[model samples]
Target: MTTNAPRHIISLLMENEAGALSRVAGLFSARGYNIESLTVAATEDPTLSRMTIVTSGSEAVIEQIIKQLNKLIDVVKVLDLNDGKFIERELMLVKVKATGAFREEMKRMCDIFRGRIIDVADGSFTIELTGSGTKLDAFIESLDKAAILETVRTGASGIGRGDRILKV
Candidate 1:
């Protein structure tokens, strides 16, 4: 069935052992599903790691993916944040040309976006910004494409709202 499907952020608490991440990624590859973004990091508990995966599919496809994830040996829990209220953020560090007129304009733009100029060079300024993917994209869009020198982004990391926590 063809229908417009929205993106989903699925968070998982899994064993921090080696190869555990590959197994989860393998499942998606074997099924030909696409993962837009993925972030995995060790949690406060040394034994577990939190992984956030972003993907899009129809309702039935997403349901199947969740079921398959729960069956993984390393995956202890999986929560589709879209099922409830959640907060998501992504980090971006962008380096832009800042010389003469562009320098003041760049500083103004960064301030307007609430980003920090983490690094300043004679001809470049590296700005760090954390926000939703859309906000990060907007920041980039607001600048002159030629002014941008480099950009690095950490994919989306998300968590449930109050009373909804993903933990061991």
Candidate 2:
């Protein structure tokens, strides 16, 4: 309920079929647990999909969530990335005002964040950046709040580092 609650990144493998995602999401909603972010995509296995769910709760709460997820009919496997060493990333596309004096400053800010100006318009520039959620947030914070026009973020996706792998 609060930001101080420990955040958890739960990765799950499930059947790549209609309603699988809905069921997963529904479970969280039904339990009144808020999902901070969720990213789902078909994995290399045609029959399976990988879903990364970001949520915050106490250790007990996270344990309960994982147990409930494992009981789902569609879920094949589940792993909490926080349980071990892992790498996480999120993608953000931000459109900012790029006119007059703002243009140079915006470009400089983007370069500092290692972001790419993927699109340019008469008065706006769209930037693409990839990194951990904190990094993305820092990039946004570095900008003038009024300069931000629109932003889209792909929720955090993560995997265990090294030999740790979640496979069917």
Candidate 3:
């Protein structure tokens, strides 16, 4: 994962106002940076929104992103979760078509991976899995022999391990 570039996995907290996400995304796109995955949701404090962003660039570019993001009017907080103590998780919904031997094997695989079989029909099964990104990838890779119809992922989201906030 080392490309001599700055790969930042950051989380931002902001007001649940309109256009705020757009503004932040626009800032990155305008600068030609890449957003590997972005996930946002309303926080426990109902008035706030949380955004998890994964992007990479040279060290200088990351510093620039930190500075520019702070300048955005609606960005209330910025957290560098790559700081190494956060608990991260992602949700993935995978649909795979199963027939004959694949049907029994698919169920077995799901059990082995601790994934839930959300739906099952004569020819397909929709499964749901939640865990760290790497675990999810491993699950998906092992299911490659089955007929994969579609997959929708919620991207990585997390918080600090303890009661402390990313911002005190």
Candidate 4:
């Protein structure tokens, strides 16, 4: 029986150092698996950084990715959060061109979506929004008529739902 592949959110705990992220990217590039989203930041401990990556692939390919990551010298741990109950969030910064009609309309949409206008200019405003990808899509769609989308950046982070914590 053939099964449709599912998207997976994988997080990695790795020692903070140069080229670590590049190495991981090299693996994916060589294998030609697209990375949908990637986020990395230093942990509170200062010695480690957390990497959250979203990808789509077959179960076998996913296992291969995990195994390849384990072989990296700087990798400390890898956790597949998709299989577990987890809370996922993504941050997006969007700059939109604004005017009279679209400005108020855009503001209304932002207010409804719980997004905040971070910066304002004579004819434009930069908005800061945080939510899942789907939510971001909706927010962007609402502003599509007014916003030309000068720039955008997105980062994904996830924590296990309930009391479950990914231990080091």
Model 2 poorest 10 in a row by lDDT: 1-10
lDDT of 3: 0.84
Give the TM-score comparing model 4 with the true structure, all chains together.
0.90
Q: Which order, best to worst by lDDT?
A: 2, 1, 3, 4
Write the residue-wise lDDT of candidate 4 on 89-168 in tens digits.
Answer: 89888788878887897788778989899999888878888988889888877667536666575667888888767657
Predicted structure with the largest lDDT when compared to the true one: 2
Taking every candidate in turn, the Cα RMSD to the unseen true structure, in Å, is 1.5, 0.8, 2.2, 2.5
Candidate scoring better on TM-score of 1 and 4: 1
Among all windows of 10 consecutive residues in model 1, the one with the lowest summed lDDT is 1-10
- Which residue pairs of candidate 2 clash? none
* Model 2 misplacement above 4 A: none
Per-structure clash totals for the candidates: 0, 0, 1, 0
Which stretches of model 1 miss by more than 4 angstroms? Answer: 1-4
Give lDDT tens digits, candidate 3, residues 1-38.
24557666888998889898899999988987778789
Between prediction 3 and prediction 4, which has the larger TM-score? 4
- Tens-place lDDT per residue, model 2, 1-168, is 567899899999999999999999999999978699999999988899999999999898899999999999999999999999999999999999999999999999999899999999999999999999999999988888999999999999999999999998
Clashing pairs in 4: none
Sorted on TM-score, highest at the top, how do the candidates line up?
2, 1, 4, 3
Query: Which stretches of model 4 miss by more than 4 angstroms?
Result: 1-4
Which candidate has the highest TM-score of all? 2
Error of 2 at 137 (Å): 0.8
**Tens digit of per-residue lDDT, candidate 1, span 43-106:** 9998999999989898888999999999999999999999999999999999999999999999
